[model samples]
Structures are given as C-alpha cells and as structure tokens.
Target: MSQATETLVFIPEDISSARSGAFRADWQMRSLAGETMGTHWSAKFSSPEQLDLQAIELSITQNLDTVISQMSPWETDSDLRRYQKAASGSWCAFRPEAFHVLERALSIAQETDGAYDPTFATAVDLLGFGPSPHSGYSYASPEVQQAFAQAGYQKAALSAETNSLFQPGNLRVDLCSIAKGFAVDLVCQRLRELGLENYLFEIGGEAKGLGCKPDGLPWLYEIEPPPNAKASLSKAQVALCGLAVATSGNYLRYEQRHGQTVAHIVSPRCQDGDDKLLSVSIFHDSCMEADAYATALFLLGAEAGLAFADKRNLAALFQTADDLLLSGRARKLLG
Candidate 1:
C-alpha cells in the first residue's frame, strides 16, 4: 500500500472579484438534491424571494433525464445505442446537446492522441464497467482484443451541420467519462435562466460554481484525496467561483483480478488500465472539459500527464502512492 505525503492549499477568493457586481444580501441560501445518472445531483443556490423550489427541482431533473435519454449506454433507446446499432457508413442523427458532447469527446481524444476515447463501450463492458455484466474475459483474451480493435475515436465521423454521427460498424460510443459534468453544466444553465446567479451545481462529484454565496463568500469545495492517503495529510479545498473542478481516481471504481486491482478507467492506447497513479484532479471553466481532462491525464500516467498539463496550461494535480505532481498552472493556483 502507498500513502499521500504532501498537501496543496487553496484559499477562497472573493467571488465579486470575478463577477461584475456584488451579490444581494437579502437572498437566502436554498438546496435541492435528487438522484441521476446512477448517482446524486445537487444544487446550493442563493434564492430570490418567492422562488419556487419544487418547480426548479423538477426542471433540473428533467434536464438530467434529457442527457440520459441521449447519451446513456444503459438506455436501450438512447441516441448512443441507436448509433451503436446503425450500419456502417450510415449517419445517425443526434439531438444538439448530445451531438455537442460527442464532438467535444472526440476533440479531447484527438488532443490526447487517443489516451481517452469515447468509442470504448465494448471494451468497457468486457472490463466489467459498462452496462452489461462481466463475463470473465481476460485482457489478453480474443474477445477483449476484438473489442479493442473496434474502439477508436477516429473511426467515427461527426457532421456539425446535421448534428449527426457516422457509425462505422460495431463502433460503440460511451460518454460516461464526460456526460455527468455536462449534466452539471445543463443544471447551471437552468439556474441562470431562472435568474439565480449565485449557486453551486454538482452531479456525481463533478461540480461548478457561479457568483458568490448569500454571505458574499465563494463556494469552498474540498478536493477528495486518494484512498491510501495518510490521515495526517492536510486536506485541500478550492474556491469554486466561476469555475468547475473534477477528479478522477482508480479507487472510485475497480475490481480485483488475479490478486491485482484493475481500474475502470482503461487507456485506449494501451488497451488496459493502470492504477499506479492514484488520481488526477483538473479545474477549468467548463465542468465537461475538466472531467474529460482528468480521465485523459490519468490514463497518460504521472510524468507524461504532468508534462501535458504544463504544456496545455491545464490546472492539474496528479497523486500517486508516494508522490504528488502539479502542473505549472496548478502550482500557481495552489500557491
């Protein structure tokens, strides 16, 4: 077993510094939560007088459901499932939101050189992390090899004008790496539409914040440390003002095979998983980007990931059993 040996401290900055105006003092803090995407979704916002909490909650749930209906691999009728079953060279149309997410996922895949891929549904399922139950397929098994051969972001084509995706036979798309963060963004959009400017929105652990709290303080979010971290390691917290933060770690989801731990986050380039780096956390203006980058960085492993983050100027923190690595941008932010 390994332990986290260092800490990064982040001070909460004034939200008004990032926004145009100060928050109103008369507003009250309100919270609403519900289940979505097989996990919980929550909101903490500065509510205006006479605001209808129930109606807002309903709208948030509906928006989350919309993402599931379009992107969920578990949903048989989802747009992704439809595209998966489409014949080779056929264009499958998608709703605007889903199309946008798919487009972004592919972009990240290309940027990372396929370290992160959305077309790994079959591989994911065989690795015991997808919609279907695992069937004892080893990494070197023929079934797994065939699934890997079929998974590649470049194999699919996107049409920006038509909002459609081209299916190349047996190519399955899974947005699990990025969809939850998109849901958080969608919820935040709804909140803004209702004139709520100060709030924190989250789905599954990916989160975003807008403006300030009712007390004029930024929303403080605690970064989750790796499971093997030392108890004495000081905790890290970030001021989520006009920003989103996402963390991905091997401990979040895994399985034991042949007395070794196998993480759910598989590297498409390697066609396998590596748990050497405990986790990676990324901060960005968009929760979706933060989420995808976290996965991509983790797959790239510690040294390469840190270099990539620095080159890209991404605020990223990578933690392993005995070491902690931070990009130049992450150091500036934490310092």
Candidate 2:
C-alpha cells in the first residue's frame, strides 16, 4: 500500500522568507496502483500568492477566476455589468468560450428543469447572499417570488450571433455553480504546463485528480454521504478513476437569523422552501460539471434532486438532515 501524505509547500515563505503574501495550494501524491487523498477547502481566494509554487498556482487560478468573473453577477465592474445597466433589455456580448459556458449552464438548467440554475443572482442576493459586508438584500416581489417558483433558465436568450444575453435586467447569473470545476480545469492545464501529470487539484470542496501521485498510485478520495445516512458515515476510500467529485449541502452555511435558519444554497426557483436534504455529492466525467451538478442537486432538495439525477443517469450520494432511505442509484454510489 502506498501511503498518502499532504504537505503545504511555499516557494516564497519557505525558501526566501519573502513577505509577498500567502498562497494556498495542495500537492499530495502516493506511489501505487491506488492511493487516497483528502482535503477540506472553502471556495474563493483568501490572501495572496507569495511563493514560486504559489506563483505558478496564481498564474493558473487567476486566469480561471477571470473566466468566472465574467460570468458572475456579483462583480460590480464586470463585463456582465453592461446588461445590468441596460436601459431596457440590452445585448450583453460574451467571449466565445464564456458564452459556451453560459450555454452549458443553460443546457444543464434545461436538463434539470431549471432546478440547477445559473440565473439565481437576484434571488440569491435578495436572500442576503455574498460575503460578509454585502448582506441583507431583501426580496420584495410577490411577482419576483412567483417568477422564481416557476423560473425557467430558458427565460434568458443567448445569441451566439452576437455573443450576447437578453433577459430581464433583474435576471443575473452566478458562475459559482461550475466555476470551481472550471478552475480545476485551468489548474490541470497549468499542471501540464509545469510538467506535473501526477497531482490532485482541489478548490473548496470540488476536486480533480490527474494521473498517479508521486508515490505512484491512483488517487483515493473519501466520500461523505448526507448525515445519518446508510452510506459511509465517516471518511473512507473512494475509487478515483480520473473523475472530479463535488458535494453541495447547507450543513455548514446555515445560520439562525430571526428564527430562520438561512442557508446560502438558494433554489433559483424557490425563495422559501424548507429543504430537508442535507447534502449531495456527485461524480461526473469532469470536476466542473460535477461541481455544478452537485450544487444544483443540493438546491433541488431530496425528492426532486434525486429524480433529476436519475433522469440524467449520473451517480450520486444524498444524505438528508434526518436519516432517510435513498433511491437505488444514490444508495449504490454512497455505498
């Protein structure tokens, strides 16, 4: 058995003791047919990059973040801002690749029946989303609330002709859905640039493992099913066959405010629904896809989310807040 161990290495901090800033990246490898890797992360950049390894990490991640920034409604000065400022409904042009990502978001939105939406920016904000400073943006639209209940991601029109978007000005999109996965893609690209084929890339809770580790083994990841579920309750080995894994749940983000346990995972379609299911983990061909899908599944709650996964033929694990039986597909994946 190849032993897997993680060590935090910094080029600036360790080598030169420079005060540039802290950059966080993980490089854990093992040598064997298979090995296990585990990391706990929160999505988003905390500090800065100040090391050689950190510089390499920044070069890749910053580019990835740029792609997501162009997609996020959260950015005040973003290219997306033009649409928000459109006098009526204006055409918002996107880079071809960026447009493709939006197109993909729309596609997944359709596949999930708008259950996993990218256009939840307004709803998310109204529910007091964003970082610490920008809190408490309330919802005042019975009409808007109704809109969310029957929200269809198809409502937004994309013009590959103009590389633009046409939707209600209030309709904003957030790439947090698939951005982490996309970041993994960028990270992998950079790893290739650095001639690193055997490495694991994890951002927040999303992960993408490429090739074998330095220890020479397939990457081993742990699966955390929803709490109180029959699936592996604690950390255990999961087969890592070049797949990216992501989990979405409200267990950590919940806060009791004014008698309501407000969770950040908002249903782009529901402003107020007591979603009981705790968390959902998805395995997919790519980390980005899996990340977005898992988040959407978590937002869909227990029944609808599971149904959506079944329809898509994706493998997943779902654990509700209280112990509940999962369908055949989820059970098998979690097991």
TM-score between model 1 and native? 0.92
In candidate 1, which residue ranges exceed 4 Å CA deviation?
1-7, 11-15, 19-21, 24-26, 268-274
Model number with the top lDDT = 1
State TM-scores per candidate: 0.92, 0.72
lDDT of 1 by residue, 151-218 (tens): 88888888899999898788898899999889888888888888877889888789998887777777
Which digits, one per residue and each the tens of the lDDT, describe model 2 over residues 141-254?
A: 453365365445776898888988885556666666776677676666666576554456666667765554333344556655444444423333444435667878776655
lDDT of 1: 0.81
Give the count of colliding residue pairs in each prediction: 0, 11
**Candidate 2 versus the native: TM-score?**
0.72
| Residue-pair clashes, model 1 | 0
